[model samples]
Target chain A: MTGTSFIFWIVALLTVGSAAGVVFSKNLIYSAIALLFSLLGVAGLYVFLWADFIAVTQILIYVGGILVLIIFGIMLTHRITNVQLSHSSIQRGVGGVIVLVIFAGLSAMILNAPWHRSPAIEPLETVREIGRMLMINYLLPFEVASILLLAALMGAALLSRKTD
Target chain B: MVDLNTYLIIGAILFSLGMFGVITRRNGVAVLMGVELILNAANVNFVAFARFGGMDLTGHVFSLFVIILAAAEAAVALAIILNIFNNLGTVNIDEANQLKQ
Candidate 1:
């Protein structure tokens, strides 16, 4: 009933709805677009949780980069152009049951868990500290992740090249 | 009562939807999308815990790293899917089941 709760519920609904569309939608393009919406919804939720940096990164990486890649993949792939990209009703029914049961179990676990918030910690604006940590304590992992990304990029190019 | 559990549950739902997509979808690209959804769900949980529970920025920073990794993952996965499509003429998982027989 509070403003925060209201916002959270709305964002949650949008996130869940678009995520379901991403799974269930027949048209690959539509599903990709739906994924964009879902990504946006997650970004908004990040904002609500006071993670402005994460929200921005989510928008930049997911909505901007990854979604574009997905759209291009859909375009490059042959099946996306045709209108018959829909999945069967049987697959939907089975997926629906499996997803629902999993959701129920997870929801129960989350709702039943006694989550205790640490009272001593203050609200920390993490950008500066995270930068410092990335440069200092977590420097190695940070560099390694970047190296991994570079490797992945090379691998992607190699895999996508036309072989003679 | 409107605390971290709500966000965690939402995250769980998103993750499950992604799992369902990965399981049922035929297209390799779509499966990659499912995987992205699952990763985003984990990012949500990371941010939530960073805010309410730990009250430190580590979770947010970790989520940033996760977002980057997801981007790289999507690029690589899509590239692989494109290769599969080029070779097989179809992206259907069932069609690519040469290993099964």
Candidate 2:
């Protein structure tokens, strides 16, 4: 096996295993911690896909920003004085069965689809092209996303206020 | 790394795991984590297609938008969860069923 494929396998295992830890861990804190590594692994995958900007964004927004928010949510809501903040689960038997079936179908479709393969051109840099597209083709959506983010910021502050 | 199907299959596994977490976890926060997992899975697929299908960075742009939306969604969802916990006294989603009669 090539070194690239070997690295992919290692990263994939870390991602999938950490994801499992997030879902299966009884301790909420442990799950949150595991989510950190899982997000990092995904960023590594993004690098392999030649999306360095996206990979950096993923790490910045997900690990740095959102993960902190999640941990804060976990800590603020639950009193530390109480018994450990291990969470509970319900209907695992049914959920697992359904997820299994869905995964099987997705795998089959992905493998069987006759995807068109073009002669791959190794684009050395994608950020400039992506930035240009965002300005020209995606100008409207870019503006809209900024607006949405502004609204979300205000809404979160409003909703999480100390006073009613 | 080279095979698109491998990345897609990894995404499928992630999506399935996230779905299972969504359906089974009692804590609202845990449910949100599951949702994040699902979103990551989709982003992986998007980037993979962009690379393998010769989509000329369009997939990267779309994934950026998705990331923005996800950030917004997480903020709103977490705020709502906090509200639920404050008014209802718990983050356990199952117990917040006031409409269940």
Query: Candidate 2 regions off by >4 Å?
Result: none
lDDT (CA) per prediction: 0.84, 0.93
Model 1, A44-153: lDDT tens digits are: 99888877777888888888899999888877886444776654323777887888898898888887888877753545665778788789878888999999999999
TM-score for chain A, candidates 1 onward in order: 0.87, 0.96
Candidate 2 displacement at residue A7 in angstroms? 1.2
Query: What ranges in model 1 sit over 4 Å off?
Result: A79-84, A87-90, A119-124
lDDT of 2 by residue, B1-101 (tens): 35888899999999999999999999999999999999999999999998889779999999999989989988999999999999999999999999997
lDDT of 2: 0.93
For B1-101, candidate 1 gives per-residue lDDT tens digits of 56787789889989998999988888788888899999999998988888788566888778878887887888888887888788878777668877788
DockQ of each: 0.71, 0.86
- As for model 2, its CA RMSD to the true structure in angstroms is 1.1
- The top-ranked prediction according to DockQ is 2
